[model samples]
Target: MDGEYEIKKAYASILESDFERAIEWFERAVRLDPDNAAYHYKLSVTYARSNKLGKAIEHARTAANLHPDNESYSYHAGTLEAKQLLQDAEKYIDGHTQPHLAVDLLKQALLLDPLLIEAYLLLAVAYGELEEFGPALQAAKDAVKLDPQHVEANRLFEQYREKLKRYLRS
Candidate 1:
């Protein structure tokens, strides 16, 4: 309604898995406390959960900017940005898929969370699809370093490693 009650309602709605209602209440809370970084942060997470990447990234970046020391906000925003870029990369046209943007986005994601093993794996895939074997191998290596036991990452590493050797020899 006004302040704390609205926040409580937002949290309750979130716990109940009523994301639409959570968004409504969170928006009201933000309106009531426009400068509250916590409110903005909560709104960002809620938006991400609802698959609204643009809004989620906007609010998460705002919260991170409002409190630069908060690594969580920056990390969350970067993860969302990477996800959006990966989606963009996965899109198709007639008979082709474009994953060029994924390189930059995945780099940005790693900057925010260097330990993001999935980002490395995805970057490897994107680079491989683009026929950039060297970069793809490097990305796969990075993923393996982060998570040596990760099934997909390990597979990518082996695949790219062999590809690189073939490319070098040929």
Candidate 2:
């Protein structure tokens, strides 16, 4: 079969939530068309869903480099990078720097894809950790705006709003 046909089959498998099969087909597609950024991006997503973070990051980075303006690829790469950074920050930090680094990563993720509600929520949490209630509130608001039905976003928005109120009172 053609590379595009294999890629389409991989996508269909992914859509059906058959991650293992998706990975197999996507790998085949990639082997057939190694330079195709879209194939790499699809493979990255499949890898991520399969909890293969290292492979996900590798393919995502390739996709991002090959198609810099592809917002989806950039967002995936930023999300993976943010996750890794957050893990490192949690392990090494004793003070405010961990949250600060999280905030920076979330900011980069948001810049890449403003509609990423998870990024906004993480940014809100990071800002709140730093006692930057204003930015925290704003980030929460953005998260809720992006995904009104997101339980975490709504909870975080209310929490940050209360924090902002307290900060203003003090």
Per-candidate TM-scores read: 0.82, 0.68
Give the Å shift of residue 36 in candidate 2: 3.5
How does residue 43 of candidate 2 score in lDDT?
Answer: 92
Q: Give one digit per residue, the lDDT tens place, for model 2 in 1-170.
A: 44888888887997898989999999998899888999999899889889888899899999999999998898889787666554544432335557888787667666656666767777788888889989999999998888899999999999999988988898
Per-structure clash totals for the candidates: 0, 0
Off by over 4 Å in 2: 1-18, 64-97
lDDT agreement of model 1 with the native = 0.82
- Minimal lDDT window, size 10, model 2: 85-94
lDDT of 2 at 94: 38
Full-model lDDT for every candidate? 0.82, 0.82
Candidate of highest TM-score = 1
Q: Every model's Cα RMSD, please? A: 2.7, 4.0
lDDT score at residue 17, model 1, on the 0-100 scale: 89
Error of 1 at 158 (Å): 1.4
